[model samples]
Target: MKKPFAIVFLLILSSCQYFEKQVPDEEALLQKRLKEINWKEVSSYPSIAECDAILDKELKKQCFFESMARLVQEKLDLDTIAMLYPEMDTINVQVTVYPDASLKFEPQMPPDNTVSYNTIAIDSILKARLVDFPKIEPAQKEGVPVTTQFILPVILDVE
Candidate 1:
């Protein structure tokens, strides 16, 4: 009876081979997955109410960008800025929009053309105009909200 019991126990122990060490390291696995993600690319563009009715993907993106441009032009007194800095033909503004619709305008880098103004003045103008900016439905990757960057070209009429 003892010999029989020993044989059965041995059989049970040998049959229960569940821990084969297939997963080497949980952290490593997570790192590999993270590496595979393209951080620069998003699955969807940030949206606004005006763009919600558009059905086509490419068209929708175009509409969103157009709406942003229109909003900025309407709010910002570009003519006044141009008068202050007559030499600058173009102003390239870099903007980053957050998930909560907050915006961060990067410090203006003086363009190649010759025009100088107080950084504070530029910052104030941008902040004030942006106050009227519509609520943005933020960009997403894997269904998670992400910050999106935009380079807006403000062409000044140098007169």
Candidate 2:
């Protein structure tokens, strides 16, 4: 009886190691992928309302977009990215086309009430652009490049 019990205990312990999953090293993967990122074509886009929200919020805080506009990088979906990283100042986005491709107006924040889907944000930190990263490397599936979208945080100097 003792021998049988010992064998069973050993078997259970040995099998537990097999249940553990080895997660892929994402940091190394991102570094390699960002190197492959084509940087010549980034752009910025914002609907009047979208920019306004950021401006209104900032201005209300006594930090105007005009004074902080230089720090804007690109716009991103706050709701979407915020879910992944609760403390992230910005989201991780990749894209091939520039959001500024068709934006001909001044790079200032939008006024009180215009809305646009292509628009993201500009804050005291960086400005973000909205674009579709045509191909997300190492596709989620084994054979297809998943169209993963994100906010590519841009760093700028407001001071």
| Best-performing candidate as measured by TM-score | 1
Q: Residue-wise lDDT of candidate 2 within 20-134, one digit each (tens)?
A: 9787699989998878765542222222322445534334323322322222232333324333323344322232222332211222332425433223332222233433322
In Å, residue 40's CA in model 2 sits off its true spot by 11
- Residue 26's lDDT in candidate 2: 100
Clashes of each: 0, 20
Instruction: Give the RMSD in angstroms, all C-alphas superposed, for model 2.
Output: 19.0
> Model 1 over residues 1-159: C-alpha lDDT tens digits?
999999999998887787554766899988999999998788788899999999887888899888876776655654466677666556667878898878776546575455456778877777766665778898888899989999877665544
TM-score of 2: 0.20
lDDT of candidates 1 onward, in order: 0.76, 0.36
C-alpha TM-score for every candidate: 0.70, 0.20
TM-score of 1: 0.70
Off by over 4 Å in 2: 19-23, 32-159
Evaluate model 2: give its lDDT.
Answer: 0.36
